[model samples]
Each structure stands twice: as structure tokens, then as C-alpha cells.
Target: MLLAGAAVAAIEILHRRYDGAVARGTLLDPSARRDRTDLDGTLNYLLVGSDRRPGESGPDQRSDTILLVHVPAGTKRAYLISVPRDLLVSIPPAPNGYGGGSDKINSAYEHGGGGEAGVRLLSATLARLTGLRFDGAALVDFAGLRQVVDLLGGIRMCVDTPVRSIHTGRLFEPGCQQMDGTRALDYVRQRYDLPDGDYGRQRHQQQLLRAMLDRAGETNLRDDPVRLDRLIRAVGASLTVDTNGVPLQDLALTLRGLPPDGLTGVQIPSHPETIDEVSYVVLDDGGDQLFAAVRGTRVPGWVTANPRWVTRL
Candidate 1:
């Protein structure tokens, strides 16, 4: 166990520094959710990483990264399920005048008006699609990702395929390489030349997150409290989480003991299809199986059964 006193002090420092940095929102509705007890307690946290910054006001925009973080009971491990942005799903009526219609899954955020309301509508839309409601949600600013990465000494990313940056004209060759904040962001945003298109980008995004978590786990805050404070402050600026009213301090403490190898990235089974002159991703029957597994805390089994959908990382 981390020295109790030091851990408490570090958490308090995090709380102080994080004050008002994260954009809080009223997102989840517990009463409307159907929790499956097959594993006693399963948690699904919707983590949306957007191109827009936290508290940045502008015209509504589609979410860039839509990840369903499903933590099965015991909190021993997590599943990073990447829902393709272009996946076609039903968007329900929202307070933001977005009438219900079948559209790209990313549209839910825009339809919800791009804040707490956006989180709410996206949560509801996902629930309607997956049959599992979110226990908490977080809207992450893409800018914050860079800061968090750079503050923590940058992440060690492995590029499985060659990625040429359209934004900066930098070429990322196939190999494990070190990335600074700028290169990392540009690397993740490229999709045009990738063989798998958006799916490859989704994989890269998941890889970035895994690297961040792995780095965080490896970083020892007790040895350097200043680094801890800086890291927490950067994270605070990057993420806005709605933990269903749970205090952020307690939430941090609860997951403090998670093992370093806890995260597993997964891609939902889907294929690109066109309708009405629009290209969209359509889920396959296996996606229904995957969703069912997540709902019942059988994700590990599902991953084992369907190895192709699981990323090597």
C-alpha cells in the first residue's frame, strides 16, 4: 500500500490543483439504467475526447474520440472499447432541438449541443444502442492530452504502421518510438492514407491512451511530489468527468490499486457501408455479442473468443 499519509497528501494536492479545472456536467441517470448483476457490479464510463477544448465555446462539433471504458467487477482490469466515430446509430431527441434520426454516432455530441447536454445525449444514445448505461462520463480536451503527455515526460508510443502526418508533414515509421505532445496529436489525427481508415486512427488513439496509463502507473509520485502535482494539474485541465455525483477524491482513491497491465483496447466489429451518398460504419452481429459481453462483465471471455477484435497491445 502507498504510505497512507503521503497518499492522502498527494490526493489532497490533486484536489486543490484540480479545483475548477475540470468542466463538471450533469450526465448520468442511474434510475434509467439496467445494471446486470451477473458479475455483481460492472461499471461503464463513457470517455469522450474531443477536438474542442474544455470550456471552449463555439459552434457544435462532432466528437473525435468516443471510447466506452468498461470496467468489470473487482476493478482488476479495464476494456477500452473504441466505437468508430462514423458508426451509424439512432440519435434520440435532445434538449438541443436535434430531432431523433439515424446518423453517424459522433453526431450525438453535436446534436446534444456540445457540453453537459452533449454528454447526456451521447450517454443516452449509447445506452439505447448497447443496452448498458454509463455510470460516469468524461469529456476530454484534445489540447489537454498534449499537456498531460508532455508533463508526464511524454509517452512511449509504438506505431504499428507507417503514419504520415497531414498536418505537419512528419513521417512516423513502423516501430516503437518516442513522441512529444505535438507529434503525438498529429499522429492520432491522421486517417486519410491509413489502410483501415478511421479504424486505424481509432486504434492509434487507443494506443495513445494505453501508453498514457502505462506511463502514469510507472511514474512514482512519492519520490517527487512536484511532478505529482504537475501531473495532476495537467490531468485536471485535460479531463471533465461526471462520476454520477461521486467525489473525485474518493474516485481516485478507489482505483489507486489497479495493476499496471489493467487496460485492454478493443475495436468493435464493424464495416463501412454507404447510404444516401454518405459513408458510415455498420456494426456486425459480433458487435452485438461484444456488447452483451460487456453488459454482463464477460469481456475477457469475449476477447478470448474473438481474438481478432482485440488489439495486440
Candidate 2:
């Protein structure tokens, strides 16, 4: 049943429109002129959650959520490493020929024009930071996330403590419960009220992801074509992939056998510090070790040794 949901999700992604340059270069090195086989090594995908709304425009448009998904060669397991948007890093010059400096990592996206150029700059920045090249890039609008959760009949999540959304003023009680689209969006967007701040929000985001996977396992998407179609349309409208030209179906097949337990979520190690009176997350030495493990495709070993870095979700 989970496989069917995965297939349905893949089909929806394939049917959706995508950018041309996302998958244009070598899988191991996006800047490489030559193409590389996806089967040869681990695949790294940069997933960005854009906070901008439809038709919204401004310099404030940034990736509120950034994750590097590492899929090992055999596709037996996958690792998701979350990069805080507030992480201070050096941004490369934008394709539009403006803006470059040490700032929040997400600044690259905003300065690069919020499209392919933004993705390129951000991907380059990530490559520089992690020493891992991207195989592909995916962008999901916040609006789409809400629709996807709602379409899946509201994902189930456990609130360890009462959560009052900083954005929406919505309150979530402590317990396992189903959340509608609006409620779910509010649930993941709150950070200020939590003790862990942004880290707590990150955990909620990861929890939402896990809930989606669990829902997929419980629901046979194929059995109800109508619901499946709605889901596909909702997802298609919200998600965009830069596959370069790799056939979407093939990529889907590569991921078909992935089990729920195979997915692991880890937070990039960082410490909070103020730079020139502005706050930022500075990657610690452990972060270097984590990225090295990712680049070496030895995340399982890294996780075993540094268990604290792994998110319990």
C-alpha cells in the first residue's frame, strides 16, 4: 500500500511542470559539464520550502525550510539533513549580477531572483558548505504543503505540549490528533512560543513529513482514483522539480522500494551567535563531520556515532 502511494506521488511529480536547468549537469557535481550516472553513487537532492505566496514578490522571499536529502546508491535508505535558514554563510554572486556576501544562507535565494537563478546560487552555496553536489533540486511552496496535508485527509501528529501558533493564533492541544490544512500549517510555523524556537519548528516539520508517509502507508491511494487525482493535482500545483532531463518515472522507480524505517532525519550541528548584532547559526565542528560523512556516503555510521544529532522523529 505504501508503494502504491509512493507511485502515485511520483506520478504526480512527473506530471507536474519543472524547470529545465535543475537536472542539466552531472549528478555528482552540478557545475560539471559532463553527465554522470545516478546508479554510480549516493544522490543528493536539495529541497527548498519557499515561504513566498503565489504572486508574492519581494526581497523577503526566502527558503524558510532547507533540507538536503541523501539517497544512498541502493535506495535502501535516505537521510534528511535540515539546514537552518538563518545559518550564516557566504553567498556566491547572483546570476543577475548583483549581491554577494556573508549573510544568512537563504539570502542567496532571495538575491538570485527566486527562480532558476536562485536555485543555482543556493545549490552552489550548499555545495560549498557541505562538499556534496546536488543531483536535483525541488521547491515546494508553503501553500502547496497545506494542500498536500489536507488532501491526505489531514496528517496525524502528536503535540507534546500546547502549541499556540505565532502566526495564526491557532492552538493545538497536547496529544495525537489529526490537523486540517490550515491547522497543520499553523502547527509547523510556530517557533517563538516553543522552548527550542526554530529547532522545535524544524522537528514539527519533520513530524509532518513522517505523518504524511504514515498516512500513505495506511491509505491505499490507488484504490480511490478520485482522491488520488485530487492529491496529484494538489501536489502538482504546489511542487516544482528541476530534473534537468532525467525521466521522472525512472527516478520514481529508483525510490519505489524505500521503507518508512529507512528514512532518517538529522539537524545540521550549529551554535547560535550574533554577528554584527544580527543572529545566525554557526556550524560547529560536528557539522563538518556530518557533511563529510554525507559526502563520503557514510551517514549511517555518522548517525550511530553522533546519535544526539539525529531527530527522534
Candidate 3:
């Protein structure tokens, strides 16, 4: 009975610690609603990784990464589709009282004022482009990502080739290795030296995500109260969920049953074009088919047909 009481108390403490560590903000309006029946009970979440420095203010910040996560009703699997930041698209009139125009998709975030406004604009842009509605949105600051990796004692990754960061001067040899927080950040930020440019960077980002998820699976957080507490705190410090009031814990629980193999990475098909000397990725017809599959919840068939776009790593 004494041991039981201690265990119960420990669980309660861990819950409270997680609650306190998370920082909440509005990502969607409470009044907004979207039909999901056509989607075969899939929920779409716009996950944006911001480049803004901590405590920095202004509309200058841009979304460094834009991923749309599709979680089906059954929770049997999850699909992560990377929306290239440089994809050229038309931005509708901003809901946040800012002007919008045809530009790189990331500009929608900057035009929307970089907070709730930014999220709204980006959401709207994606909706316009994909014809799918978002159920919620999450913004993850890269700074917090570094801390989470550090807390995990570092994430192990395999580089395909010898790569060097143009910005950071860090070098990564081809092979599997453990990366600390700073090195991991550099690894994801290197695009110039990569053969595929931003596409290669996108693949690396997805690899990092897979690594993190695999690490989380290996480390049973429920069994390690100390590590779980620290991880929760790190996540809370770095993430902001929309104002619909879904707790991060609840979100984590919803995805807890997902297996690493069940997670698939997709790249939206596009072709590079230079407009007025500025390079941009123009979505191809395959991109439309991709979005349609997502909207209709026919991803399995879509993946079967367009296997080339799926990320193997």
C-alpha cells in the first residue's frame, strides 16, 4: 500500500510538471469549423517551424519549415508532407488586416504579423492551395528543438555523404553518429552543400524527426519519471499550440499508439523555375494529385501510384 501511494504521488507530480512546462497560445479561432466526412476522418495539422530568435519581436520572422501532418481517425498511421518553403503560391487577402499577394508561401507568415496573424494567414494559404481544412496548428521554435535533442542525450543519425555547413563551418562525415544539440541544428540547417538544395534539407529534417520519434519510442517516458519530466518541460518551452485549448499532453496521448513504421514522409511534387531572377518551386500536376489524396483520405492509393515522392528514410 505504501509503494502504491508513492507511485500515485509520483504520477501526479509528473502530470503537474508537464502542465506547468507547456506554454499555450491561440493557433485557430474558436468559431472556425471544417467538415471532415470527405476526408475519411482525417485530421490535418499545420506544423510550422519558425526561424525567429527567442524573445525577438517583429514580422521579419519566416517559417523555416512547413509540414502538414495528417492523422487519420483510426490513428493507425500518420502522414507528414513537407511543403517547401519556397513554393510559389497565391496568398489570399490576410484575415489579420495585412495585405497579401502572390509570393513564396513562407511570405504569408511574415505578412500576417508573425503570431496568431501569421498562423491564420499560413493556414489560409495552405487551405487555398490544398483544398483541405486544418483541424489545428502547432508552432515549434527551433531553439526548443535543440534543447529537446540535448535532453534526449542527443539523436543518432546517418549522413549519406560528407557534408559541411556553409553557415556554421561544422563538418559531418558520411556515416552514423550521435549529434549534440548544436551539431544537430547545424545538420538540419545545411542546404547549400546538399545536392538537392532545399529538397535535401527537407529530407534531412524528416530524418531528424524520424530519429526523434524512434528515440521517444525506445525511451518509455512513462517508465522514467525524471527523463519524462525534463522532456515535457523542454517541449513546453519550445512549442505553442493554437488557442482551441488542446493540451500538449492530450495531443501526445493521441499519437502514442503510432508506430515508427506507420509514419510516412511525403514531398509535394514541384519543378524549379526562376521568376525575375528569384528561384521558386512551382507545384506540378502531381502536387494536385497529392493534395487530392489527402483531401479524400486516399493516401494509400496515392502512395502506391507516386512511390517516387515518398521518403524512404
Query: Which residue ranges in model 3 land beyond 4 Å of their true spot?
Result: 1-13, 29-40, 95-97, 243-248
Backbone clashes, each candidate: 0, 2, 3
lDDT per residue for candidate 3 within 1-313, as digits (tens), equals 9999999999888678777776666665333325332233567888888998988748999988999988877787888899999999988776667767889999888998896678778888888899877777788887669989988888888898778988778888899999987888889878888888888888888888888888877776778878877888888888887624445566667777778878888899997899999999999999999999998889878988898888876
Collision pairs in model 3? 26-243, 27-242, 27-243
Error of 3 at 55 (Å): 0.7
Worst 10 residues of 1 by lDDT: 31-40
lDDT of 2 by residue, 45-108 (tens): 8888888898775656887888888898889888878888889998877658866788899887
Give one digit per residue, the lDDT tens place, for model 1 in 162-257. 878887888899988888888888898899879999989988988888788788777777699787777777877777777776677666666666
Q: Rank the candidates by lDDT, best first.
A: 3, 1, 2
Q: Per-model C-alpha lDDT, please?
A: 0.81, 0.77, 0.81
Model 1 residue 56 lDDT score: 70
Off by over 4 Å in 2: 1-34, 57-59
Report the error of model 1 at residue 112, Å: 1.1
Tell me the deviation in Å of residue 229 in model 3. Answer: 1.5
Model 1's TM-score against the true structure: 0.90
Candidate with the greatest TM-score versus the true structure: 3
